[model samples]
Target: MRKITFKTLTKVFLVLVFSTTPSLVLSQVNPSPKPKSDFWNHVQFGGGFGLALGSDYTNITVAPSAVYNFNEKFAFGTALQYSYIDQENFYKSNVFGGSLIGLFNPLPQIQLSLELEEVNVSNTYQDFGEDYKDNFWYTGLYVGAGYRTNNVTIGFRYNLLFDQDIDLYGQAFMPFVRAYF
Candidate 1:
């Protein structure tokens, strides 16, 4: 087996960062002489949720995010994510994570986005009259494209470094929705 070291991990991480940074690193346009008075101006709220309930299974997810639009074509933001799952007589899991998000719109109806995140996941279970808990770090790097409208954004993203065993996003391809405030 190949032993994974911190140095190797760091190099991989740096490469991902550098490759995505350029598109989002452009200079911001100078603001107009008259600024808007409303605090909500140029700001937007967006996120997604999932819920499932059954006799033997329960799952809930709440992900909230905020973004500041630099212009019609550029924006930067952050996201807070949480999810909980329980299976009767089986196990329970909890997840918490946050991501730095960057978005760019090259056209009026198309948007490209990237997100980097670090997630902490914990699971608890009982076996043979014994209880145990496990915790680990799950990192994600995603690249996506969306269809934009006046009030909503619909997108699909693929996690470039998703791990089937540790990541909260169960599938590499995930759909997302966002509404503007």
Candidate 2:
């Protein structure tokens, strides 16, 4: 009688498994190519919305964007933004903006994003006088990353040049979301 050593048994087990497996299993290891689709198939639509209400503060926001994929790895898009804020016994403001956006996907589930925006804001001071309006243009740049799924994405971004003195967005960190059509 012969006893099989551990090393010999491992070698024998591997040989049997490989020899018994069908050649079809090994041949199908390569991934399939992506299907060709129409231009419209690569278009996606989604955006972010915000609402805040309290005795001392009221804010509402509407932002929407459209994205077209140049390829599986790159996309470019645009966004329209509007926000209004009214503070108790203080002031009221209206902000309108538009953004140019770009995205890069190095992996199937990871994304990198960049955005540039121009915002025009109108402010009416209630404490000072009646209908005293101030207007200005603000430029914003953002950089962020997120996780993506077949139909949805969730991400966070930072305002690279946040103006703390202005007090529009008190925090530099902002969240973003998207849904594909």
Candidate 3:
């Protein structure tokens, strides 16, 4: 006669049950493949917002973009954003920009990014036309970093302002926040 200890009995039971039901065993082994690599590759579309600080003007920026996630912590994407500013008491301007971005999320509570961007600024209500609109063409490139937590993302970047300003040709620091979905 043989005596079966509790551990031996449990092993025998599992083998008998699993051998009869492979689906049950397989289900226990797999758990949905790790959540599709962090929203960009999984979600078809997403959006974010920013605050642009410039020497002449400050503006609120909003953008909607398509995201492609490389993994659980990184993404590559593009955004189309419009900007507006209140300049010099009764002066205003509108701008449009496009950015190609790479995002790095080291922790779930924090994210960092670098962006290459092109911007165009158009002043509508100034005293002069081509003279004031001379500041209109703002083709530039920039590198930026960002932080994110609780669905809100904040970021900063320095840009090489190009093809427009002669005397004021320099970089600008921009900080922004947006809801990530």
Candidate 1 local Cα displacement, residue 131, angstroms: 2.9
> For each candidate, what is the lDDT?
0.86, 0.87, 0.67
- Indicate which candidate wins on TM-score: 1
Question: Candidate 1 vs. truth: CA RMSD?
Answer: 23.3
Candidate 1's TM-score reads: 0.72
Give the per-residue lDDT digits (tens) of candidate 2, residues 1-181: 8888999999999998888786768787867878877978888998878899999999999998889999999999999999999997788999998999999889979888999989999988875556677899988899989898976778888889898886667878898886666
Write the number of the candidate with greater lDDT, choosing between 1 and 3: 1
Residue 28 displacement (Å), model 1: 36
Ranking by TM-score: 1, 2, 3
- Candidate 1: misplaced stretches above 4 Å? 1-39, 165-167
Over 4 Å off, model 3: 1-41, 48-61, 86-90, 124-131, 160-171
Query: What's the alpha carbon RMSD for model 3?
Result: 12.9
What's the TM for model 2?
Answer: 0.69
> Each prediction's TM-score against the native?
0.72, 0.69, 0.54
Lowest lDDT block of 10, candidate 1: 23-32
